[model samples]
Target: MISLSKSIRWLFCLLLTLAAAFPAPAISAAAAEPLALGSSEFYYLAGHMEVLKDPSRSMDFKKALEAYGRGEFLPLPGTLNAGYGRNAYWIHFTLKRGVAFPEKSMLSLSPSYTNSVKVYVQRQGRSPLLPSSFSPVLLGSDVPVAERPVLNPNFVIPLDLQADEPVEVFVRVYSKGSISLTGQVATYGSLRNSTYYSIMIQFGYLGIAAVLCVMNLIFFFAIRDRLLLYLVLYVFTVLVNNLAVSGMSTLLFPNHAHLISDYMVYMGIGAQVLVFSEFSYHLFHDFAGLWLLRYIRFMSVVGVLTIISVSLGFYASVVPFALIGIIILITMLLLTSKKLLVSMPQSGIFITVAFGISMLGYFFQIFRLIGIIPLEPGWEINMVEPATLVHMVLISIALSERFRITERQLADASRLSEKRAVEIAEDMTGELRENKERLEVALAAEHLSAERQNQFLTMLSHEYRTPLAIIQGNLDILAINSENGGEEESQELQKMRRAVARLVDVMDVSLMQNRMLDLQVVGTSTIICADEFIRQQVDAVRWMWPERSFTLHSELVEESVFGEAPLLNTALFNILDNAQKYSPCDTAIEIRTWADGDFVMISVSNGIAGISIGDSESLFDKYRRGACSHDTSGAGVGLWLVRKIIEEHGGTVKMNSAAHGRISVGLAIPVERGETPYCQKK
Candidate 1:
């Protein structure tokens, strides 16, 4: 048993000796090849470097060097992108001078937000055994700008190299934000030129951003539009975030460079997302009541929380949230703006272009941060700055378009209102015209009815006149026959004759009135001297009232009036009859004729009893009578017929009531001037 155990121990010892003779395969890998500095302006060190993730963050410079010597560090195939974490990363690369390399060189590391960066350089020929051979430089946001070895916004380490000698560079970085590294080895002259170019570009971007901010700010004040204010704030946030990302904040605010680099960058990102979302909300006012608005509001809250978390020093935790919120917000805005295209074409197109550009920029940046797109040399400036500028311009145009659209909508509404009012007015006018036409038709029908009634009355009067004449003839014969009978019979027969005579007179008056009522055109008219006409009418009245006293006065200037002879004679007879009937049996009726200007005047004066002054004019109305005529036997249409007939002859008739119960009726007719006469239907 002792001999067997001895053999096993010898075998284990032999295996241990063989394992110690060769290093592990991991350590057997070849070291990174040294890059020779050439006449090129700058050299990218990412692909040429080795990386080691120090999760414990306890590894010092010596340990990093030891690990690199053992080839434990892995070669980085591309840019260093150790996403958001509290981890530390160690990067190592060897740089050698070429035939035309400059004596002075610099190692630049980006971005500036790294919490701590320590660089250790050891000349290859002398650095393996002695710690003193290594030169150390400190840089990062944690290190004050003034205290850094090289005064630069980003971490810059100056290198002293000997001719034909290679030097090893080791960088240890720890960050509380997204950990990304892009290193460049440049000569002094090249670095200066690159820095000047970067400064010029940055300043140009800043100038554009400032102009946009100020312009939108002015627009906000001028128009009192909150969308412009939100746009201004969004643009300002973009400027701040971009400055922080590019490390220009260090130069702008030297005292608070660390704060800007660490917290404000994330905060600015959150603020940009918040403000841009608000701008979108207001920009898409037509969609304010849509269900998508709720999602936008939710994203806005996320942006606000991101800002709050970053302010509370949870920058690394909130960075991804802020970036995600921006993506969601931009995507929502793009889709929403596209939807608006149909309703608001100009505004929608402009905003869509703006958001599309912004989205492209953010995608590039996010992809780079997440290591999806590797960072290359000479590609230091991301598309974000240019995209932001274009975005701001297009967004401004979109806002102006929205304003124009709003104004157009208001104008359209006003025009619509006016059109509606006009339509209503036209409707009312049309209704009034219809009513007026109806009223005209009714008036015409009433006038036709009056004419028909006048024609029927004329026929009835003619019929009654024939019968009354027959009765009068019969009464006359009876009176003659009864003259030989009893005195009572003779008296009765005389009464009957008087009654028949009164009926015949009434029939005559009725016939004349109806003729006047239906008179539209006279068949013929003749001129008559006013003096002769008045004298003839007065003689007829004196013959009718043989017992009554009558007088005629004439002061004519040979004036003749054109009229129908029978109508004029009837009008004069009615006036005379009225005067004789209304006056006392003992009073004398006076008739006068005179010529005045182009008219002939006929006047009849009579003594009236129980006639009020107010009732004088009403006597000319048909069926009108005076209080004193209640006991008299006469139709009341005599004066009305007189007035109608006189008016048809282009004349006027008026009654004047004088003191002492006296009334005078006057007729004025225009003298003939050898012109044709026309008449109108009543």
Candidate 2:
């Protein structure tokens, strides 16, 4: 008996060890309560669903059944978000029909971009072990519309449920992109209505995109803006992507449904990234050295590589790249918009709002894609389309604003150019008028010279004074009108005033030359006090040049000269004027008058320090000016006339160079005796 007990204990210990090594398959927990299909039009199945991931992508119906019995399927509320991978998902749910439930209903899965979907339905009391007990339905983007269990954009399976009887449903989904799934059970009528609404919404978005594309193309042709061209291409890629994601491409090209579903969707993503990067680069080209541009260029390269990968049938590999590209895109948009807002407020407002909407939509989608926001049935109404629609509209408005601003700047420049042209024309007109007056005076002088010399001189003086008065009057009016003008205008007015002064000086020189041409004294001589005459001339010249200094030294003893008063006045005035013109402004002019034994002596002296001196006698010749006189305005006839008039009055004129580069001109006239009436003849 002891040996038998010891043997039993050893056997039991061996049995316990075997049981630890290989335990029995665990019985799955009771399935969640079946959902009751009532009078409601639609029911969300996510809350009542269970999900199991098949990473190997080789799980069949038999394996799925065995796994469900062992409770390998986990309860999934809301929806399934199996991120980017080549993974398959199995979803299980049970539904019971209430008294008011429809006999025939539809089981729908979204967002309709899934590559493959298979639905299996098993009626109550059906044998769980027999494959024939479960009816299978094939649907998805990869399945042709005609081959699908129902004619709908999304995957739909028809279900016929018995009253108060529970029906078991299982769905298998596989995708090369993000694997996000949500489902609903609805009456056939409800499913039809919902599907039609969804199609209408998607088509409406496409129509808006098409319209925007056409409008931007027209703008591009009209304005030749490259930014608009990039925008058009970007929008076109988005439209193509929408068509693929919305299942319209599969219906339109039924024979190539697999190609459209597999390649076109990812290709569209890459193409959009490429084109949008170009658009952004051009839009912010003004900021040439921005760091964001480098990143955008990198994204463009990634986009191209993604397209290449998709073309090479690396669909699964391209998905992660696409997600990374999207994240970069969102980052670029936000950062660029912020920069634009600070740089250009008017246009930036529209751009910021547009990018903000787009970013929000993309953020929501990406969060759902990465399982941050659980997928819900409401996700079927994609925010991207609506947000993109508003975004595109705002961006178009921004482009329009830029166009308007450019036009306004151009118009302002044109107006400024026209104003300048008018001012130049007015100046030319004034010059022509002055020249016409000068020509008339010359013609009149020629005609009168043949008749009488004095008559010609009279006409010359009158005609010259008339034009001078007119010019001075106009200049005064212009100066008053431009009192509040800019500095440039004020400077222009000063130039005109100087030109008028120069014209008056030329007239004076011409008249003096004509008077000296006769060389015959026509007026009677008069007794004039030398000191008084010199003082009067000095006072007159001081008024003309208020800024110059003049010093006078007189030691005359009641001495008088017999000569024409006008002729003597002209000679003294010419001497003083020459001194003022050649000397620097800050220097002083010295005039001396003294009585000598047989004549009254007069001298005018001024500093000509840096002037190049030639023969001083040649300065008395007509039209002979000093070397330093280039910057001063003169016809060089003043000293010649002075010499002639002094000689006619029985006086001698001599030029003398004094110390320190001072130049002096001396005039010695015979004093009058017994009041003899002298007719100074040349």
Candidate 3:
């Protein structure tokens, strides 16, 4: 049994040796010598190179080189791209330097999405070393940037060669993303120009995408349209994905480049799919079936979840989600287009064209990444290059076309409305003209009536005053006669005379106010001391109503005022009279005068219980009276006259009532142009 077991083990060992001795062919080899590096500065590498597949991914540099010496390598089919594969690829090439070529050359591997890249060179004196052994020169995403032969966003390898010396080069590449080993060997100047244009194209795409994003965002807000909003999101995701896939994000997030580069593909794909789904939903919403919409929403949610999963390092799940999402999206678009073709034919046609253009570009890029299509060396094209710009332009065109249609509809409606308005105006024109003629006749009659009324009032005022003067004469005679009779008779006579005097005063003041309103009696103003003028008015009130007790208080800082003294005196007297008439006979009426900034204020307060006043503004209206004035025997025009006179002096009047049923009337008058007085406030 032991001998049999040993024979079996020896057979297994021999089989392994045979497998190692004859590796499977990957591609065919080129018969010509490798392209020489020269002053031309650039050489397409794939067509002139051979490639080997390291299925174990454990094949060290030394073994790979040994395999190369045995002619085991296969020529690169066209370009090296093995999309999302576990196996690492080794590309083999030889370079002979011309006398015109520089001593050093740069090799730039394209498409920065690869996770790891390593280059091995066999120069005139050195032997190839294993990758496990430390190499003074190494370059890849896994290698620290400081350890790289040349620092670059892409994997850059530096070569030192002598004139006419043949040098062997090998590059190993592997990635979770699509493995693309496309590169160029050139002089610094050629490489620099190539890099400049490549960078320009990359940044140009990003710049235009950024601009579209902003524009679409603005369109969303300006037009209040959700389609533009989705467009903005789509543009943003595409920009981020392009930045990640194109390897330009390393420029922005250098320290965190590995993190960005590793996960951004999944993130970008998930986000792009989700945003595109949303955009399509909004774009074709009119024709979207319920199930189709539900499917879209489901896929969108899944895409979002996939993005979360990817961020958490479940990158392997992205492919399934993406595939499912693509299927669902295509079905949705087709169903929507079919339904829209029958319902809204023009819009459906527009959508179909735009979608076709966009999908063409999308598929072109996807196929290129997956190695389904060969990439021509030195000829670079981004999937978004033709796709995104055309998509945006077409969508914008559709939107503009819709806007134009809407405008035409609105214009037709407006024209119809204008025509109807013209007809209505024509129908109403005669009625309006007739109304204007009638208004003119009515105004003329009103003017004549007002004139007659004014003349009658003037005549009445003269006649009334004549009779009141005669009645006052008769009352005086009767009082004299009653003085000799009895106390009751004299008191009756005094009451009769007081009533007559009050009626005459009311009539005179009313007529005077009428004259003031009619512009017949304009009172001229003169600078007068407000404190002295108010005191004189208070003294007159005391002399007239001796039985009614009153107190006058003055706080004069700037007492001079520009107003008619007689009018101001009359205003003050009317307020005092009203205060006395409304208050109980025993209650004293308090009149106070003070100076506020730039004005003199006269306040008359009385403890008139049950006097309920509402809005102070309405109280100043002509003929308006306080609620408590029902039993009072005076015309309600007293406060109104006071307000009118004060307002004429460019001042204001306000009325307020306190908690104790104390009503106060405050009158403000502008101070005259003069020096302020020394005040002894009381």
How close is every model to the real structure, measured as TM-score? 0.56, 0.58, 0.60
- What ranking of all candidate models by lDDT puts the best one first? 2, 1, 3
Instruction: Estimate the lDDT of model 1.
Output: 0.76
**Measured by C-alpha RMSD in angstroms, how accurate is candidate 1?**
21.7
Give lDDT per model, in order. Answer: 0.76, 0.77, 0.71
Give the best candidate by TM-score.
3
Among all candidates shown, the one with the greatest lDDT: 2
Clashes of 3: 4
lDDT of each residue in 1-682, candidate 2, tens digit only: 1232343465457435544653432324545567899989999886677888898999999899889888888777557777677779998888899989888888888877887888889965797556677898887776767787666677778888899988888889887677878888999889889877877888889999999999999999999999999988988888888888887775567677765675667788788778877887888777434555676787788788877877686756765766656655654565556667777778889988988788777656655565556676666666667777887889899998988888998999999999999999999999999999999999899877755866666788888899889989998877766765642346556656756664565465446445567668376767876667677678767766879999998887567787776777778878888888878788999998888888999999998843445658888888888766777777887788889889998899999887777889899998877653332221
Per-prediction CA RMSD (Å): 21.7, 24.2, 12.5
Error of 2 at 460 (Å): 42
CA displacement after TM-score superposition, residue 6 of candidate 2 (Å): 76
- Once fitted onto the true fold, the runs of candidate 2 whose alpha carbons sit more than 4 angstroms away are 1-30, 123-125, 250-258, 421-682
**Decoy 2 TM-score against native:** 0.58
Candidate order by TM-score, highest to lowest? 3, 2, 1
The candidate with the higher lDDT, 1 or 2, is: 2
